[model samples]
Target: MVMSLGQGLWMAINAIYAVTVVHLTPGQLGVSVSVAAAIVLVCSIPLGHLADRTGPRTVQMWSFLASAPLTAALLFVSGFWTYLVVVSAQAIAYRAGRSARKAMIAGLILPADRVSVLAYVRAASNVSVSIGACLAGLVLAAGSRLGYQGAVLFTAVAFLLTGALTAREPRVPPVPATAGSALAVLRDGPFLTFTILDGLLTTHALLLDVVLPLWVLRRTDAPRWMSAIILVVNTVLVVGTQTKAARGTDTPAAAARASLQGAGCVAVACVVFAMSDEAALVPACLLLVSGALAHALGEVRQAAGSWAIAFDLAPDHAQGQYQGTHAMGADLGKMFAPAVFTWLVLEHGALGWIVLAVGFAALGTAMPAVVSRGVRMRSGSDPVISTG
Candidate 1:
């Protein structure tokens, strides 16, 4: 929650701060962010390997400490190049910590409780991010460059505190590096396949964050406020029900089943969203709400299931590297989502949404077989997929 809150505070105002205070153009900002994301994507595996060798707790703490100053450096960025350097450095520090953090969770928690614990953390994160965003709104309402600067400073302090807290966390012993290079993950065909499939599943996030709001405004009669309303509803529902949705996904098969259910909800949401385009205002609003609810439900199920698959499939000795490799899929999905979703939903409209829906459903349907086959190939026993 602390980490997410800090992220929320910065994210809510960063673009505006860049435009108004740092005087960067939208295109420059986009390029800088994309570049930063690319850096994270390229660096994650190496950093994860470091964590595997040196211990996740140590790497996580140091990464947080490193990020504090880099985040604060945003205040001094005046040009596009300076902003890019600062933001990219900050993203490198941030992304470097991610796999270690996941490894820490896996190291400390029993597998049976992993999904529930992750759900709880995610719920808290949603609530805290909402609070942080509200606070950022107040800061922006103060309407000055100094106010934005203060927001950046607050984020830096938050990172410092989080780093301090992490430093004091109970340490988990490092796993000794094996004979092969960390890049050996590249040679693991089944794991590579799983990661690609996982990445595809993450496209649903783009559907919610990018496609839905644009579709509502450009194609439907629903009021603009409905978008904000839908976001709030999704947040509230996720916070309230994620733990419940996480139940019963204790095995690979069960996790795959949950993912399939999530895909079905997402598909239904697309159909409902399409109907809103031609409906009366009141009916459109209702359909929009219904779609948002379905999307949120799908998000909850997918998150739970994905966590299970990722944690369970990872080799015990190479957890950090494996987690890092899994994370790459998400980064890749998010990087491509804007262009892909825009072309599909905005350019082609209802038929495009249906096509996406079918695609998602097909992927979900294939997941069980894919997971089963991959696990069998890896372990030579179907029941090993159920192991914690």
Candidate 2:
């Protein structure tokens, strides 16, 4: 619940910032987000390893404390470079703590159903995001920097409190580290493919970050409040759908195939979104919401496949490092997508929509094959081709 509150707070602030600063110019905002994500990716492996060696609680506290000022200061920044630095600082702290959190979650769960539990966590996150987007819309309507800044400050407070809550929870034993294992983990074929495909999926998410706001502002006649309404719609759909989709997964192969189909749905949504205009706003929003629901489904399957495979693949004590590597793939994709999408939007107006559609379609088509190989190599089974 605390994590949900915190995420909502941050996302609300992010939505405001997206309109006011973050998505101001596709190039600058994209670069800032990309830089921040890159910093997180760079810091994740080391932080995860450290968390495994030492308890994650102290690290989480320091990270939150360090990040608060940077997030607060974003309101005062007028230039892109300052935004990049400050946001990147926040990202580093956030991702370090995030890696620790993911590793810690794995530690808390029974191995037999870890994937399902992760799906629940994902649903919690989606629900939180929905709430946050609704609140963010209210804040954005106020059109005050203070409201925006305050929302982010609230997020920082949630981080601090999360640290406190985590600290109170008894610490777990450290996963023992081994020498030269990072390289070895990277060399493992299934793990590498999982990382790559997951990275591509992250790019699909960036489609929401880049296109949705632009779509809302440009194509719809709805009031500014509609943006948040749409976000609410998207988040609610995800939270509602994820449980059923996740429960449908009875096997690892089933999980991977479901995820791939979800990706295909996102591709179809992108195509529908690209063709939308004022006349098509209602259907477009529906399509967009549908895409979000599908993405959530894919995310659950992806999480399940990746976690089950990674847990089986890693030696008991090496889970932290394994988790960190996979997370970095997501961070890398988050970093790359914004810049590329920004350029696409700038270079071609509506044409950019076609580009994203093609990109998503290609990704969806390729995902099953990749996951099949990954499942076979990691779990020694042919992955299912049908979604549950």
Candidate 3:
């Protein structure tokens, strides 16, 4: 419940940030997001180390508690550079907090069920985000800066409350890593492949962030209100489809199948988005909603696959480090996608969208084969592994 509330408020605040405060051209906005994401990627490894050395709960509590004020400070700032600094800080806090949270989940949930729980958590988050985005849209439409400011301010309060809630929870026992454990992770080939593949999949997904908005506004002559359209599409698909999409995918093989199908969906949706010149709002809406659902399905399956694979491979003492490294792949995708896609759009126009579509489609087709190989290698060494 706390996670849901936090996501809802954060999503609303994020929409406000994109619309009001972070004033940049499309490419510049992409650059800002990329830079911030790069910072998160760099920080993730160290932060994971911290979570392991300390405890994931400790990291989560402190990060959450600190993030509230930093986020609220955005209300007073007016300049782009200042916004960047503050937003970057928020990004750091969020990434660190998330790693800790995921690690905490690892401690309690059985590896096999972790994907289902993650899916449930994601569904709750999307539902909350939808609520938050809708409220933000209402505030924007009303032209109430004070009200919008109040909504953001309230979000900070909610974060504080969430921190308090987390503090009251039981802590996980600290897991220790021996010398050379981190170095060992660096040399693991299948692990590296999984990370890289996950990164590529994620990178393609983020094209929807800054680029989609700009495309809608500039190419379709969409009203500023059209931003809400995309959000709605994402909200409905996530809320409606993710749980079912994640169901019946317990084994590594099954999970890979779901991911491949989901990837195909993403490719088709993106192509439809690119071809929507005459269809206007309907095509854009379909692209946004269908793509979101497909991408989210892939997230559910890939998350399950990654967790199962990592838990199988990780030494008992080094779980946190492995999870953290896994998390960094996601951050790297977030970092690189914006810059790459922004360049593609500028240089190639509609061709860029087609390229992104094809890349995603290919990944979808290929992931199952790769995952199957990894699963086979893992099973050979650890036949009775506990997979989450």
Candidate 4:
């Protein structure tokens, strides 16, 4: 929640600060963000290795500490290169912290409780982000440069505070290095396959946030405010129903099944959203709301399922590195989502939506098989390097 608070505060103004305040072209901003993601893909495994070499708690805390200064450096970003460098550094820190945090969860939380607890954390993050966004909204309302700087400073402090809190956590000592290369997780074929499928399903996020708004504005007769309403509904559903979705998903098999179910929900929602394109305003609104509901439910369930699968399937000692590799797959999907959706959905119109729906459904249908394969490989050979 503390991490998400900073996310909210910064997200409320990060783009505005970059584009408006620092006077960067949208193209430059996009390039910088994309570059940072590329950097993360390359850097995540080594940093996660650091977590396993030192300690997850130590890595997590220092990542946050490192991020605070980088985030605050935004105040001095006067040009494209400076802005790019700052954001890239900050992204690496943030991604490293995420991997370490997942390792911490794996170390501390019982397998049976991890998904449920994560559900609660995600739900709380929503509420905290809303509160933080509201606070930042006040500064945006005032429209002063100093106010923007102050809001950013608050985000920096939030990063610092999160680090301090992480430092207070009971130490989970590092796992000793295993034989072979640091990139062993990369050599695990079944695990890599699982990550790719999981990453595809994770594109559900961009489906809602990026593609839906385009669908609403250009293809549908839904009111312009529908996007905001859809997001609100999503948040409320996530807060209310996440625990329920996470229920009974204690094992990788159960989690995999849950993921398929979630994917089906999102695919159905996509079809529903496509049908909204030419409807009357009332019908379009109803369709949009319904689609958003299904999408949000799928979002939470997929999240819960992925967390469990990623944890249970990874070797205990290398959770940090595995988590980093897992995250890189998801990041790959995110990086490509906009372009993929634009070509598939926006360009071809309704047929594109069906194609997308089919893709998501296929990703879902394949989850069980992929997950079972990973399990079999792990149990048979311990293909990935492990201490045991």
Candidate 5:
């Protein structure tokens, strides 16, 4: 929650801060931000490897702490280059910590309980982020240099407190790497395939946040306010139903099937969304809500399945690197989603929506076979595809 609150404050204000305070052009801001994120892709794998060699708890705490001063330093960033350097450094620190934190969770939590527990944690995070966003809004309302600086300071303190609190947790021992076994996750062909599929499905995130709102404003007759309502509906459902969605996905087969089911839900949501473009205002509102509900449910199930598979399929000793590798797929997905979905949905119209829906469904349907192959690779039998 502390970490999220800090993140929420910065994220909500980041672009605005760049433009208003640092006087960066929007284009420069975009380039710097994208460059930082691209750097994270190169960092997560090695950082996770470092955490496995070191202690995950120690690595996570330091990563959190490292961000504190960098975030605080934002107040002094007068130019684009300085802002770029600080933000890039902060991204490397916090983003790499994700692998360490997930490794710590895996070390502490039982495999069977990981998915449900993560669901609850995510729900709580959503609530906290909402609160933090409200706080950021208040700062925006105030509209003073002092106010902005204070928000930045508050985020820095939040990071500090988060790190200190994390330091209190029992330490997770390092996974010793042998000459032959270092970076073992990179060598696992089946797991790599799974990661790619999972990443592809994760693009639904960008679709919901980026394309959906634009679609509402540009294509549909739905009231403009309905876009915000759609987001609210998604948040409420995810907070309420994520745990239920997470249940019954303990094994690799069940998790794989859940992922497929989730993709199917997203496909349905996409179709509903496409149909909304031609509807009356009242009908469009209803369709938008329906699509949000389906997409939210899909989001919940896919998240659960991904968490379960990340934990269950990973070898215990190399948990950190494996978790890092899993996360890299998400970064890759998010990087491409804006470009991909914008062209497909916004520019191409109903046919584009149909193509997206079909694509999602195909990916979902194909995953079971991939999961079966993975299971076979591990256990020397195609057990789950037939039985599950």
Candidate 6:
């Protein structure tokens, strides 16, 4: 909740703040954000290794501590370089702790209940983000530099409080490293393939975040306010239904099936969204709402399924490194989402949406087979195990 609130407060105004206060051009802002993601991508593995060596709790606490000051330092950035440095540092600190935090969750929950717990966390995060974004909206309305600074400061304090709270959580014992090097995760073929597939599946999220808004603005006749409503619908649905979606994703096979179902929902949503292109405003609004709800359901199912697969496949002793490796998929997806969606969906129009839907279905269909193969291989001679 703390993390989501902080993120929401800053994200609501980050682009405007950069342009008006930091004086960065749109292109520069884009480049700097990309650079920050790249930094996280490059550092994820090493930080995960660090988490494995020490413990997730320790690494997570320190990461929050490091991130708080860097986030606050954003208030002082004067130029593009300074902005890049501060943003990049904050990104690094945040990403560095992600795997450890995930590993900590894995350690805390039963395997059968991980998805449910994750769903609750995700739901809570959405609620908190909504609150934060609404608060930030009030601040943004004030239109003062001091208001923006206050938002940043609020984020900084949130991080500080989070770090302090994290420090107080019960500690989990670290698994002793069995391998000589952290790079061992790179050599795990099945896990690597899983990561790639996970990355592909994650593109759906990118579609919702980047493609949907652009499509609504450029392709549909719906009013601008509908975009905000679509997002609200998605958030509300996730908050209300995520735990229910995660109910039966306990086993690997069940999770794989859930993912396939999720893909189907996403495909249906895409087709529904496509129909809005030339429709009347009422029809377009209804279709958009329907699509958003479907997409939200897909998001919940995919997230629940992915958690099970990820936790099931990761080696117990190296959960941090494996989870970190899994995170690379999200990083890569975010990095390429804009260019990929522009070329594949936006520029091509409605046909592009169909193509993406088909692609999602294909990926979803293949996931079960891939997971089965990994399970078979593990059961044969490799015997991958999770102590958590």
For every candidate in turn, the CA RMSD to the true structure comes to 4.2, 4.6, 3.8, 3.8, 4.9, 3.7
lDDT digits (tens) for residues 266-305 of candidate 1: 8888877877765678998999889889989988998888
lDDT of 6: 0.78
Write one digit per residue (lDDT tens) for candidate 6, span 1-388.
7977886666556766776778876457656766777778888888888888888999999899898899899889999999989988987888778888888887787766777888899898888776776666676567689988999899999898899889888787876766446877786777778788877787787565456655665677876445446656776788898889988887778888888889888888888887787667889899999988888888889888888899898876787888998988777765765456645655677788788788888888988898887787767655563222
Top-scoring candidate (lDDT): 4
Backbone steric clashes in candidate 5, count: 0
Task: Report the candidate with higher TM-score, 1 versus 3.
Answer: 3
The Cα error of candidate 4 at residue 136, in Å, is 6.4
Q: How far in Å is the alpha carbon of 221 misplaced in model 5?
A: 8.2
Q: CA lDDT, every prediction?
A: 0.77, 0.64, 0.66, 0.79, 0.78, 0.78
**What TM-score fits each model?**
0.82, 0.86, 0.85, 0.83, 0.80, 0.84
Q: In lDDT terms, how accurate is model 4?
A: 0.79
Q: Model 1 scores what on Cα lDDT? A: 0.77
- Which scores greater on TM-score, model 3 or model 4? 3
Write down the lDDT that model 2 would get. Answer: 0.64
TM-score of model number 5 = 0.80
Candidate 4 residue-wise lDDT, 1-388, digit = tens: 7877777656555655666678876456556666777788888889888888888999999999998899899999999999989988998999989999888888888867877888898888877765666665566557689988887788889899999888799888888775335687887787788888998799887665556655665678875446556666777788888889898678778899989989998998888887886778899999999998989888888888898898888777788888998988877775666566755666677788788889889999999988887787778755553323
Question: Which is the better candidate, 2 or 3, if ranked by lDDT?
Answer: 3
* Candidate 5 residue lDDT tens string, 95-208: 778899888888888877878889888887766655665666666556677878988999999999999998899988887566225556777877888888887887787665
Clashes of each: 0, 0, 2, 0, 0, 0
**Where does the lowest 10-residue lDDT sum fall in candidate 4?**
379-388
Question: What 10-residue stretch in candidate 6 is worst by lDDT?
Answer: 379-388
Q: Give the lowest summed-lDDT range of ten residues in model 3.
A: 379-388
